[model samples]
Target chain A: MMSRGEPSIRLESVNHWFGAGETRIQAIFDASLSIERGSLTILRGPSGSGKTTLLTLMGSLRKVQEGSIRLLGQELRGASQRSQEALRRRLGFIFQAHNLHESLTARQNTLMGLQVHGPGGDAARQNAAVIHILEVLGLGARIDYLPEKLSGGQKQRVAIARALVSNPEIVFADEPTAALDKDAGLHVVRMLKALGRTRGTSTVIVTHDTRIIELADRIITVEDGRLLPG
Target chain B: MTLLLHLLLRRTPIGWLQLMHNRMRLVAAVAGIAFANLLVFVQLGVVASMNSVIYLTYTPFRTDIMISAPSPQLFGGALLSRRIIYMALADPGVADATALHLGSMEWKRPGGMSKVLIVYGMAPEAGAFAGDTITDQQLAMLALPNRVLLDSEFKDVGKDGSDMAIKQLSPETPLEFEINGHAVSAVGSFKLGSGFGYDGALFMSDQTFQRLIPERTSGTLSHVLVQLKPGADPALAVRRLNERLKSEHVQVRTAAQMIADDVNYMNTEAPMGIIFGIGVFIGIFVGLVIVYQVLATDVAAHMKEYATFKAMGYPHRFLLGIVFEEALIIAFLGFMPGVLLGSGVYQVMAMATDLPLGMTPGRALTVLAGTFVACALSGSLATLRLRRAEPAELF
Candidate 1:
């Protein structure tokens, strides 16, 4: 898949530490990896193996230390918060907990994703985009239901819809299937792969599930904080 | 500008609806603020009513000066002679001087028994009425020598049950009571309170008041009510009178000065003023505190939600704008109930209340406006925590 290599994402010797001096927890230890564009890349690790840290670092959730990280041709090592947020907008984020705003309905939450990405306050565009995404997610019937009202799988689907609705160049899902049953979980992974290939959005899913790792175009394993050789 | 308004409105849909979900808390918040507003309105209204009560002395009988004996502060010692009545009138600057009787009388009724009645007796033809023609009740008693003026409530002034219910006493009737035993007659009676207590005053010529209380006639006249010519200065005349009466125990005061003194005396020297002041301080203090607490609590509960908005690219200015909107809504809502409750209180006080309760439209408006401002301040104050919540910390 990476014949001579075009990197969709490139991290060079990234070092990240958390907390301070004596209490410092090294979340990432000189870790670096690259993935080709238009491919489904899976980062396989234990819960605290820093797979999330790697995804966030690649997504520009935090500034890099001791490294040059390029995401979608944008240099992230010294990017400002504004530039980083803009980079984040170009990537879809699906969290484990579905961190959707509870006050808003499921449909409204999906629409919020469109609102955040589109030229702000384009009501018609936001509505159309949300309608299209919900229909694709098979959530047309439960659009008006709140997150509490929706089943765990439906919530995850809404989260997936939220993630893909923006048509981001990168879709990074951190344990999106963690909270679901086996069937719902595989269904989400299948949908993510299908949406990635069809939309041509580069997908990077972090999971401990062996079942989903097999579905990735490339699966990279990590022991402790270090990536194992493919 | 338009964009700012639009975005703020769109974002606040959550915050606005949050208030509606907790109806009891919202009602409690509004009721607390409104009660404070109402307290201020009622206090101010009653204070205004006190001023309205004095229109009789201050308006119609526009007397320039009043010369009262025993000096009103120690009001009971105000006993004087009727002899100087004509001598004071003789002065060109005086224009005219009327001797008035300020004393107590014993009156007896069949059911109510005998009680001391306070009387303000002046000439049958005095400036007390300003020139308004006598009402029938005032006219009936004036025609008879001892026909006492009775309002809807006719008090027995004589205390002796002699002419109970006045089967209409004749012109030459003499008052039987003795005040230190000086002879006098109960001549003509006019109307009761067409000036008396919380109700109206009963009018009678000086002779009738003197005859009823012989002890007062022998003293140097209770009070000399005087009117001056249009061009004359009452202050100058009062100064001259004060100088002349410097040797005697008397006070010569202008009507305006007397009214001011009366107002100041009541506000400072009376318990009513202290109560009114306390009520006001308590109202403002409690209202402000309640508003502050409500705002702070709401903000605390919604801090995470607000932080999410802030992290989602919303500016601090937009957040501040939402706070102001919340403040405006809370304050305005709180103010209405307060006004309604306060007006209800004002109505209660207005009926049969000795204390004048008046709500000047301007004062009412000011109180409500003050409620709004206090709420806005509290609402803004509640947002102080937003400064500490970092967007990163929020996530």
Candidate 2:
């Protein structure tokens, strides 16, 4: 285990490719960036810019093939499976699609975030934590409703609650507001900003939403699989 | 235990919830499983019924040992010489012995239709039969020439014999029939049921049997029934008789050995048991396929959701657990209806065929265990596709 350090994430000279032989194509090239504690960063890029790939690599969802990525002060280059799993536990992820289990209710979906830690603590406390997060996200009345019954924005809120309920040090979201209306999108971004200031939880989002771009503390742009000057 | 149960209940029942979410798919999967179970139950039931028939057919003759020609099937071999009965009586373990003559002949019914009847010719004494309906009085009735005892439960001689134009024969409603063109009178009745090969049975004295079938010689016999003395071991007596009659063209066996031999012959030599066994295999295959389809489709439908779970660091083991849970649930749910409906079918078949066919605890447990294992195996295989749901692709 490595000691805690400043900046939730640090990447240096990261190079990644897909496939092999003649079919091989590079996806990330000599990219280096660092995200600080309690900061909201947005990854902005055009289509086929490999922005999502960079996000996944930093989130520990993808292996660092070349260079070094230190997530939470632990180097992820050639890391063992166990260490990777441990790193993933300290981070949360949200996709462009809400990806909520259609069978589970909003409260149940939120509870899954805690469930990943395995059985620990009292059931009552877990239930209280899940309920508090759902209510905080303005889903108190619809907590018992399944995903199919909720609107697009409400489901997105449930997803957000799921990511934040576990008290993760950093969160990575890809286009988290694409399905929401203008007001809902703005409200979600402001909520993340508030959480960053109050809890010191860092966040990195990938989106082209103009409203979200304006609220970002930092913006990184990628074009043709290469990071440009921020 | 309470704490464990509480913890278990606290965990979200994702598998059950997912299965219940698709009502139509669940119904189809369950129906497919039930149909497969039904097929297996009926096939096994039919084979068991055949065994029951053989057991019941031999239940009446209460002899300690049987000396007969070396034939696998009963009443379908070369006739044994009556000297084998005399040789069996010489054994100190044997109390007495009697020769039984068996033959099958076409009997002309009242409506001019002919049906085959199995004839059992024995002496006018109670030495051969045990405490069956063939009592001294019934044997005495058979002593008179051309007089025989009819099987009251006899329907007909063949599969289509039940359609014959003859009322169910009882002692009170005596019927006259001709065997091999020889006129005979059925003055009494017994309770031996019809077997698969013949429609009915007739009991007569050796003299009357010779008169009905003139070609049968008096010295030739089908079986020699050996009655053991009090406290005599049948196995020892049978061993002694086989040794004593080793020089003769005959075999000695206890009643149980005879039944075992017959069952083995029917299962291996005849096609009925083999065909039914194949049916059971086909049933299991069908059930496996149905469960696989349901689980695989479910995993495909929720690929993205599973990917989300992976990204959440839930581990592949947890996802595998959910699939297994669904399989066990389906197994339990489908087995109940399948067994219930199977028992009902057994009752209907028993009533229709008059065979001792019913569910045994052992059979039910075996099938239940088989179903659980098969479903679990299918569930594990179905999760292969789930492993390919890459969280990186979710973007």
Best by lDDT: 2
- Candidate 1 chain A minimal-lDDT segment of 10 residues: A112-121
Highest TM-score against the true fold, candidate: 2
Q: Which stretches of candidate 2 lie over 4 Å from their true place?
A: A73-87, A119-121, A197-200, B1-10, B90-95, B105-116, B126-133, B155-189, B227-249
lDDT of 2: 0.83
For model 2 the local lDDT of residue A164 reads: 85
Error of 2 at B237 (Å): 4.9
TM-score of structure candidate 2: 0.87
* lDDT of candidate 1 over B32-102, digit per residue (tens): 88878887776666555544554433432336787766433313445655545554565568878876565
Query: Compared with the true structure, what per-residue lDDT tens digits does model 2 show for residues B236-269?
Result: 8888888899999788888778878888887767
Docking class of 2: medium
lDDT of 1 by residue, A171-203 (tens): 888787777777767777777677667866788
